[model samples]
Target: MTYCVGVMLESGMIFASDSRTHAGVDNFASFCKLNLFERAGDRVIVLLSSGNLGGTQAVISILRQNGKRPDCPSLWNAESMFDVALLVSDAMRLVDRRDGQHLKKNNNGFHASFILGGQIRGEPPRLFRIYAEGNFIEAGDQTPYFQTGETKYGKPIIDWAITRSTTLNDATKCVLVSFESTMRSNLSVGMPIDLICYKLDSFAVTMRRRFDPDDAYFTTLGKEWSAGTREVFGRLPDLDW
Candidate 1:
């Protein structure tokens, strides 16, 4: 299992994903879950994947290799972010068609999910969550974030703090906090983490980084957040009347 999250805000979007993938206690490994596609001044797209690593990797490879195919609804050619999402979903379905039966015969289902976020030339930034069934839902004003895999542990912070008006920097910070929260609670998710930030109208990724276990900034932020949480908890009035 893994954890991937994306936030679509007024300023732009922020994305983060853990690198851990585990087949079993002894079979754990790290694999990048964040994928990016950029055409300077044209478009910038980020894909956060979770679930069957093989399936998701195959789908991403297909998109990257055939993005220029005239008849293929590739991310680079899609008219809108929504269209790009459809193309991704279609890719998921195609992969499922090819491998689902074999996996199921071995008692494993075709489990994969993705968080697709980015902007095209004329459209505003958008975020979407695509399931294994080849269907997706976009992030909206009321729901401006999406999470895939090991999501529950990190959702509360985003639910409480993320908004359409959130700044790119703040959104990035929030995602880091979310990632820290998830890493603390789940053994299957671990660093180093991949992060990307895109600013509206920029049509390019504004910031990208990989946070290793000893990254000073991340370590400091994690400690600060934990201290703050403890402080807040201490201040809450006791119910022991």
Candidate 2:
């Protein structure tokens, strides 16, 4: 399992993902679930993935290769982020057709989902999540972020603290806190965490970072968040019996 989030703020976009994947309690490994496609001042794209590793890898391989084929729809040639979403969706479907039936017959469901977001030269930064079945939905003012894989434990903090007006720096902090919240509660979502921030209209990745357990910022944020939660809890009025 994994935990990945994409946050869209008025200032820019923030993307993050945890690196753990496990087949069983005894079978565990780390793999990067975050991928990036950047074209300097032309476009910037980030992909956060969850679900079956095979399907996800297959899907990405296809899309990366597709970008080089002139006759087909590809990220490099797509005019808008929405079209980029469609290209991702189609790549996922192609992977499903190639492997889904074999997996299903063996009793493993063909499951993969992705959060794809970034900006093309002429468009605003955009974010979307594509599901197992090849359909997707975008982030908007009404819902300025999206999460995939082991999402429940970390969702509330984003709900309470984030907004479209959030600055990229603060929003980046929120994602770390959100990831910390999940890591504390779930073992399947381990790290070194992958993080990337792209300022709106720049068409280039603004900040790219990775946080392992010993990283100073990640360690401090975890300790502070825990202490602050306890401090706030103690400040509330006692409940009536």
Candidate 3:
């Protein structure tokens, strides 16, 4: 399993993903679940993926290999982030069409989802959660974030902390905290997390970092956040019997 999240804020957008994939307790591996397509000053597109590794990788590979498909609307030719979401959704559906039957016959399913977030040259930064069926939803003021894979473990903190006014730096901090929360609750969502931050109207990514288990800031945040949670728990009034 994996955990990937994207936050859309008035300031910009933040994207993050964990890199662990496990077939069983004894069989585990790490592969980057984050893909970035950047044209530097022109555009920056980020994809965060979750679900079956093979399926997700296949979809991404298709996007990269045949980015100019006329029928599918590939990412390279997409005019806006919304169009990019459509293109990604088309890719997911194509993958499902080709492999879904085979996987289902074996009692497996072609399960995959993605968070597509970025900005094109003339458009505002936008974010979308693309589902397995070639459909998607965009982030808006009331729902400014989207998450996939092992999402329940880490969603509460983001719900409490993220906001439209959140700064890029603070958004990064919040996403890292969310990741830390997931790693503590689920073994399947292990680190080396990929993080990308885009500032509004820049049409480029402002910051990107890889946070491994030993990264100093992540270590510090993990310790501090855990201690803070425990302290807050203790301070809350006890329930009446």
* Residue pairs with backbone atoms closer than 3 Å in model 2 (clashes): none
Error of 1 at 183 (Å): 1.0
Residue 72 local lDDT, model 3: 58
Question: Residue pairs in steric clash, candidate 3?
Answer: none
- Each candidate: what lDDT? 0.89, 0.91, 0.89
Q: Could you estimate the TM-score for every candidate?
A: 0.95, 0.95, 0.92
By lDDT rank, best first, the candidates go 2, 1, 3
Error of 2 at 182 (Å): 0.5
lDDT of 1 by residue, 11-30 (tens): 88888999999988788988
- Number of clashing pairs per prediction, in order: 0, 0, 0
User: lDDT at 104 for candidate 1?
Assistant: 96
Q: Which of the predicted structures, 2 or 3, would earn the higher TM-score when compared with the native?
A: 2
Clashing pairs in 1: none
Model 2, 108: alpha-carbon shift in Å? Answer: 1.7
How displaced is residue 135 in candidate 1, in Å?
A: 0.7
Q: Under the 3 Å rule for N, CA and C atoms, how many clashes does model 3 have?
A: 0
Write one digit per residue (lDDT tens) for candidate 3, span 96-140: 999999999989879999999999988888889988777888888
How accurate locally is residue 105 in candidate 1, as Cα lDDT from 0 to 100? Answer: 95
